[model samples]
Target: MSESFTINRKEQLLEVAARLFKQRGYAATSMRDLAAELGIEAASLYHHIKSKEEILETICFELASKFSNAIAEVNDIYFNAEEKLRMAIKSHVQIITENTNQSAVFLQEWRNLSEPKLNAFMKLRDAYENGIRVILKDGMNEDVFADVDEKFASLTILSTVNWINEWYNPNGKMNAEEIAQKLCDFILGGLRKKLVTDINYKP
Candidate 1:
């Protein structure tokens, strides 16, 4: 086979594997199932992929790298904490929406990764969360945000945004930009310190 054909076949295998892993769960998806989906024998599937773990590893690490790179770019920009946080939210939502299937597999199946690989993945994950935590800390230190626990705030922000892959629909009413803006607004609204003058006198 030509080089182009070989590369295309490998990508197709990964795509199918991602879909199956998302729908069926990584532990439940079999190499034979992937082969059957591709209309090829199990042995043929081996030509492109060595094992199911390899496919899961590829999917998880590729997404980890994408997120790591995005956070790095956001960190380089000369912006305030709020702006950086918004950019991070937009970047993360864009990545998830653009690669919904792979994102789902990445979110759900990462725990299935083996020892050293699991440790490596966790480090990347921690770095990503820490990037957000740093932004929150900056905002609080500058008094741009309320006096909230950075760790809990970061966890809240990430938990709210990361689950977008589970329910976001590409064909839905909102695109990624709209969704990101709304999420940014929602999350930032909570973080920003409210002024006493802004409170309504209900008495």
Candidate 2:
């Protein structure tokens, strides 16, 4: 196969593995099953990679990196906390929607990692989560996020956003961009309504 075709095949493998892992969990997804899904012999699958863990790592690591990059990009923007939060929500959701497979693995299989690798991935994952929490805290400090409990609010937001991979079908009613915008509206609206009002005008 041509180089492009080879790359495509490998990507196909990753995508399949992501779904299988999501549905069956990592340990249950045998190498033989993966090979059969890809229309190749079990041994032939080795030609492309080392082992099943390699595929899991590839999927999870790329997603961890993607999440980190998205948060960093949002943080670098010259905007206020509200704008940053909006952008963070939009960017994070968009990345997951675009890379649903990797997103699934990242959300579901991180716990299954072994040894030093699990610790490393969890560090990156914590940074990503904390990046969002920082945005929320900044919003709270600026009085843009109202009187909400920061930790609870942050986890609620992240959990809701993270689980989008479970029920969200891009082929469903709304397009990815539309789904993201709707989520932004729902989250921001609630936050906005809870904003602390001051007596700038006596009404």
Candidate 3:
């Protein structure tokens, strides 16, 4: 096959693998199953991808890298903590919605990875979480946000957004931007400190 054809076949393999992994769960999806979806022999599937595990690794790491790059871009901008966080939320939701299948697999199937790859995936995952934690910490320090446990806050924000792949419908009422905005509002509402007069105080 030509070089372009080779690359296209590899991408097709990864796409099918991601969909299978999302639908069947990584532990249940066999190489034969993936090959069947592609209408090819299991042995021929190996020509495009080394193993099922390799496909899992690709999906997980590709999503991780996207998250890492997003936060890096958010960090580069000269925005207030709240604005930065809003951008991060939007970026995250967009990523999930754009690649819902791969995102689902990335979230649910990562644990199936073996020793070194699991460790590496954890590192990238932690770094991404820490990026948001830093924003929360900075917001608190700036007095723009209430003093909250950065770690817990980070987890809350991440857990809420990461599950978008579970129920987000592209053809549903809300688009990704709408969901991102609502999430940003909801999360920031909890974090934003209210002034005494703003609390509906009556003297």
Candidate 1 per-residue lDDT over residues 1-203, each given as its tens digit: 64553558788889999999999999898888989999999989878777778898999999999999999999898478878889999999999999998999889999999989999999999999999999999988877788899899999999989988889999999999999999987886655666655332223
Model 2 stretches astray by more than 4 angstroms = 1-8, 191-203
lDDT of each: 0.89, 0.82, 0.89
Model 2, range 1-203, lDDT digits (tens) per residue? 54453557778888888988988889888988888998898898888788778888888899889889988998997368878887888888898889887788899887788868888998998788789888888887887777787778888888878888889887889877787788876787644554345422124
Output the worst ten-in-a-row residue range by lDDT, candidate 2: 194-203
Q: After superposition, how far is residue 43 of candidate 3 from its true place, in Å?
A: 0.7
Question: What does the lDDT read for residue 167 in candidate 3?
Answer: 96
lDDT of 1: 0.89
In model 3, the number of clashes is 0
Name the candidate that leads on lDDT: 3
Better of 1 and 2 by lDDT: 1
Clashing pairs in 3: none
Q: Once all C-alphas are superposed, what RMSD does model 1 give against the true structure?
A: 4.1
